[model samples]
Target: MAETILALEGATKRFGGVPAVRAMDLTVERGTITGFLGPNGAGKTTSLRMSLGIILPDEGRARLFGKAPNARTLDRVGFLPEERGIYKKMVAEDAVTFFGRLKGMPAGKARQRAGEMLERVGLGDARKKKIKEMSKGMAQKVQIAAALVHDPEFIILDEPFSGLDPVNQKVLESMIRAENQAGKTILFSTHVMEHAERLCDRIVLIAKGRKVFDGTVNEALGTVPRRVLIETGEGPDAAPVLAAHGAVTDDGMTGEGTHRYTLDLAPGSDAQDALKALVDAGVRLARFEPVRAHLHEAFVHLVESAEREPA
Candidate 1:
């Protein structure tokens, strides 16, 4: 049995009697990275806020460390809200130290930890830099350092990658992996599927304020049809053999005499088997590629399915 770090039972919230999150259930286990994923206005932020006791759920409950959230329990958690809150006038180190002190660290220890955190986040030279003086990416990193300065047992980052350039996004991803490797449990909410697909051990997807799926990345991928791209001579038409494999569609010609086709592998069928069938049919091959389903595709597929369901 896994040790659960956080659990939500029918956790729900509303604004002006309009539900933003409805009967959402979630569990984040110890020492694992969980992704709380959804599109904009899908209630991810609402759910996270409710989980941390920052906002009360209209109905249902939230538990942290097997008990109702309280100051002592919250002390063991570090959080970065989706909205940035660092003070523009404060120096980078001072901001981080301030957060550490708020978490109960002594002044001396908090200052020391702040220095270490700033250095760890690549802001050693920026320790004295004011938040207003740093680039958006640098300021974001400073906030991240502040969140970790307390060295909490669990960390919740709400859209940590939002607004970061591609390079900085990769940097944040690496930092996340490093922290998880240090045995800290993490739960991050993101509308971006690429980040979750690469970093999560398990993912919980929300749409329209309700959870629609909960599983590993592979399981999520399985929700959509497996796709493969095949290329061959225009003759013999790979369609005949591919039709038996799954849904086949022409992908347009690639060159003067070569054509491309897409195949959605049938249930329990293998791509290799389909390729073999194409070869056995004497189809001249130019290119044969297996296209793996991305988490974005799975996210879209699941959300659309939920929409189709009669509410």
Candidate 2:
């Protein structure tokens, strides 16, 4: 069995009589990229802080590497907080090396590692430039390199892709993949569904300070109903036939000559059954394809379902 790298059992935190996170149970196994997903103010940062022992949890427990997080265990962890900061006067390479040294690397080795990391992150040319002279994306990449310079076994990144353009986001995604491929246990927090969808082997979703879902991408997708797009010939409308097989419209049908309709399948309802119904009814089908459920849809469904649960 794979070793559990991190575990939080009933971890809870509160501020001023209000809960920030409540009874959260999460476990990250070794060598897996786990995406901690939630919107802003959803307690992602707080939970991470607690896991790192930066703040004491109001209740329950958080363990890193099967023991309480502290200086010893933390040396094996690399963390990039949501807030980014670096010494304005410090050279990029120097800043990265400084952090590596703090993580217990020898000064000479830290400097060597920092140079290699900066080059790998596409900042080789800017290694001698002061951090204040770099662009926002460039500075962010420097911080990321600094976090990894010590070669920690585990990595935690909070909103690492935030404030990055699409191109830079893709760059960060590639970096994350490289780290995972290097056998590092990575846990990254993000509100963006696309990042988690494309990169994570598992995802844990929190909403309103409560854990709403936890599983693989496929399992998370299974939480929401599937959708199928159907386009029928003008001769016969397929909407009515589909509606009988679990098709629902948020708004009542309004458009005339509408040959295209999207059907949401309820639990246990299969797209094949809908197609068979359409064929048996002699509906002229122009197109039939199952629309795969996206991570965004699954996330929304989970949040909405949690919201609807009784207090």
Candidate 3:
């Protein structure tokens, strides 16, 4: 059984009489990576902040480890807020140590951890340099290291990949994966579907401040119809056989002597039947493959469907 760590009960928040988040409820189990996904102005960040207790919600409640979001719970959790802010005048290493101590870490231990982190991020030589001297990527690594200094069991990272280069992005990816492997429950939010798809064990998709989809990537992908690309040595007439099995999207473009078409299956479609029909139609098959759809397609489908509905 999964150990429950973070949860929200009727979590709601507003700004100046405008409802930002509406009774949001979610559970992030311990020792798993949870991805928070949504488009811009979708209240992903606002909901996260309310959950972090950095901003009190106008309504609802957020609990960390069966307790309210308070200093005690805060100490046991690592957070990299969406809004990044740090002291520019302090040396890179010292700044890390200061933040670490604030989270109840011993000064000497925090300093040692800071040194190790700086080294891991390839900034060991720049430890004495002020934050202003470090590049944006280096500063970002500092932010990440600060979050891990106290070895919190739960991590909440909001757009932790923003402004990072591909190399730094990979570095953070490995770190997140490692943390999860070490039994740290993490809830990471990002607009980049590729990272969320590959990194998260399960996804909590949000739209307009409400949960749109909550499940594994496979579950969400299953909600959409599969598009199968079929290439045959026969011809366009094969469409008749393909459609006899399922609806197709081919436009009679079977050549310049080429036989290629597409089939779109309805929900709960049995793709094998369609393949069998094509084979039985005497169309010598050259290539037949299911078009792999990821989180992006499923997300777009849900968001567009929602928009098409009445406001």
Best by lDDT: 1
Assess candidate 3 and give its lDDT.
Answer: 0.84
Q: Runs in model 1 with CA error above 4 Å?
A: none
lDDT of 1 by residue, 172-219 (tens): 899899999999999999988999999999999988999999999999
TM per model?
0.95, 0.94, 0.92
Which candidate leads in TM-score?
1
**What tens digits encode model 2's per-residue C-alpha lDDT throughout 1-311?**
99999999899999998999999898999999999998789899999999999998989999999999999999999999998877879999999999998999999999999999999888999999999998898899999999899999999999999777798899889989998999999999999999999999999999888898999999999887888877776565677788877855533333553367788987788899999999998998767889888999998899888878864
108-226: candidate 3 lDDT, tens digit per residue: 99999889878877789989999898888888888887888788999999999998999889888998998899988999999888899889889988787777788999998887778
The lDDT-based order of candidates, best leading, equals 1, 2, 3
lDDT of each: 0.92, 0.90, 0.84
- Model 2 score (lDDT): 0.90
**263 in model 1: Cα distance from truth in Å?**
0.7
Model 1: weakest 10-residue lDDT segment is 251-260
Give candidate 1's whole-model lDDT.
0.92
Which regions in candidate 2 have their CA more than 4 angstroms from the true location?
250-258
